[model samples]
Target: MIDSAVALPQGRRQRNKARVQERLFEAAVELIARHGYDNTSIDEIAARADVARGTFFNYYPRKDDLISEWSARRGTELRRSLVTEAGGLEPGDTVSRFHRCLAALVELNEDRQEVNRSMVTAAVRAGCLGARESATAELFTAILTDGQARGEIGEGLDPDRLGLLLRDAYLGVLTRWAVGAEQDHASLYRELHEVFKVFLIGALPRTAHRDCCPHTA
Candidate 1:
């Protein structure tokens, strides 16, 4: 098994394994939704999934592994949204795409502060935040790389470096909101958009910058 999982399920055995994992993940999510992540026990999750407590470990070696899956599904959904929300497969300008990404992030957790707080807190406790942050950076890198290919971002800019910078700034906003820096969803949305604007000031191509800030030209 690769990283405690089959790389891909080609046979009935692997397919069955995948289905069991899906059940475990959904069960954990339901419990975490009702009870805080920390308060939810593996035994409870297993019972909710109709599996023995030991069976849960067969799929998820650790409880945090389930949490990681829970967290990653959201990220995968958000990335898919960047296209689906834009209508079909055509991508928009990188600037607008980036904006949409951050906007969706706020909307994703805005109404569920307690849930978001609980999950993020649990992720931190599980020491998985760094992995999550790395995933975000990887997404940003892909976005920047796409932009560069489309001639939207500067050719000289290092996509990896810029991506990490954007990730840091992007997560910084969420970090504050997650910790109650923003009192409500509306407040969090505003900060996310505002921070994205600030990031764009430097992130934009020189020519594009002039267009955005006409007076600067």
Candidate 2:
């Protein structure tokens, strides 16, 4: 086995790389918010982060890659929250878990509306939000797969397609809220909640329990 001391430098290098990547994300997000995504360039991002262009590429192959990483990180955080809220993805608590995740995300975005809008614009232009191979899609697909296995959700549906649909709908609401007026944030949150409310109901198995239909009037 390799000596722990020998591996220490490698661990340090990994930590340094993560720090540099985080700085680049902060710089790029700020610039994109101020100058718009199309106008922001790699060189500018490097300059803002006070790093060389090559260093930026070492972390992210391209600007789109950076945006995808940011979106994926957010998705992972949401999944963590869902697991925590629902006690590890209990299929019967799917609707409640989704609500908790959305509420947390909305509360987060409400504090950084402009940055959220810029990020959404970049994500849309880069087509990262809908990427089938994205972490965001993978997480949702896993959720649906487990739900189906537990007979808590529709079994006939393709989990991958359903995952993409759910992701797209989420992006749509997020983008709308990011671009909408501050005064309308509450209303927009309601719209987002309603969208998922409908989705959860629709995704239920035909023989789902009455408790599964959380939106019953």
Candidate 3:
């Protein structure tokens, strides 16, 4: 799900740095997912990654940097799914495409609910959740901008603002799911869709057709 925009590092030093960063992210995520965020520390993460404590700090100045990297990957995966669901330049149903994209994201992360919960907690504590320039928000904003141009979304709303709001809403639901998943993942998924329905209503124009909205001139 990596975007082509991110090129692989050519030099040995750069490659090694990238590899170490990835290992740190993987180790941190695994630990945080299994144990709660507060329960996991820089020492634990460094040990899990088999790197020295100083090495970990060299790659990531703060523990939250690992979580932020993981979040960016998740956002990229979701964005890729959305692009694929759009059928690549074909006239597509934005609503259906969006649902499919969201479904893919939920399916991808459903098994790691505890990890998601921990990540959310850590992100909030580190103020990462408030970052408007996050990959997740950027991707949503791009999609919403297209939807607005195509008359699939409400004209009155600013695409960037609406996108941020939608992203926040989804993140909120994700936190809720991570914290309150006493039942099966399917039940929690249903709640996500229900919340999305409200978002759809808010985002779409009132005159939008039941099946798919008509394009504007």
Candidate 4:
């Protein structure tokens, strides 16, 4: 007879492991948001999650690892949304598509403003914001490269440089909004749309055929 004690099923073990990881992640986010990153401890996270300290170690080697993983997940989601929303538009339509996507993103964030602010605050305190910045740069690079190849974006602008500038611009705007520096998201978005319109007009290929004229609404 097989020793049941010695032979734990793989599937059950995997499910339990996944559940533990999820709990730990949730706990980390909550604790960090409440106490700030530096003050949060692994033991506190484990206690809050109702998991043993060993389980926390098994899931994340360190508290910072948890923060990094969480930040990466959030960054991935944002990148996916940006790519999905912007992918279908032609190169010349990049400006309008971007404006629409930005507006949608702003709306989404407003609904989850507190959580978003908490995550941003935790990430900045942990120094993981730089990783997020790099991820944003890469996402914008993909967008710019595709736009350029399709003759949608202007020729003189380097994709890498343009990507960096665009990432910084969007991040700056979001930061301001997240910090409550701007109370009127609609007006902020309108101003940004106009700014992007002027910027794109100078950056997009002059010879590119425009199916739609850029308009600031």
Question: TM-scores, in order shown?
Answer: 0.73, 0.75, 0.81, 0.67
lDDT of 2 at 15: 75
Highest TM-score: give the candidate number: 3
Worst 10 residues of 4 by lDDT: 84-93
lDDT of 1 at 158: 88
Which ranges in model 3 have alpha carbons more than 4 Å from their true place? 1-6, 84-91, 202-217
List runs of model 4 lying over 4 Å from the truth.
1-10, 33-35, 79-92, 128-133, 181-199, 202-217
Model with the higher lDDT, candidate 1 or 4: 1
* Superposed model 1: Cα runs more than 4 Å off: 1-16, 83-89, 111-113, 202-217
Give candidate 2's error at residue 134 in angstroms: 3.2
lDDT per residue (tens digit) for residues 1-217 in model 1: 3643336546788788878888888788778877888789999989989999999888889777866776777676676767555433336788878877877787777645666766776766676545536666777788888888888877767888887787767666666776774385487778777877776656666777556755542
| Per-prediction tally of clashes | 0, 0, 0, 4
Better of 1 and 4 by TM-score: 1
* Candidates ranked by lDDT: 3, 2, 1, 4
Candidate 1 TM-score, true structure as reference: 0.73
- Which digits, one per residue and each the tens of the lDDT, describe model 2 over residues 140-182? 7777787778787777678899888887887788777666656
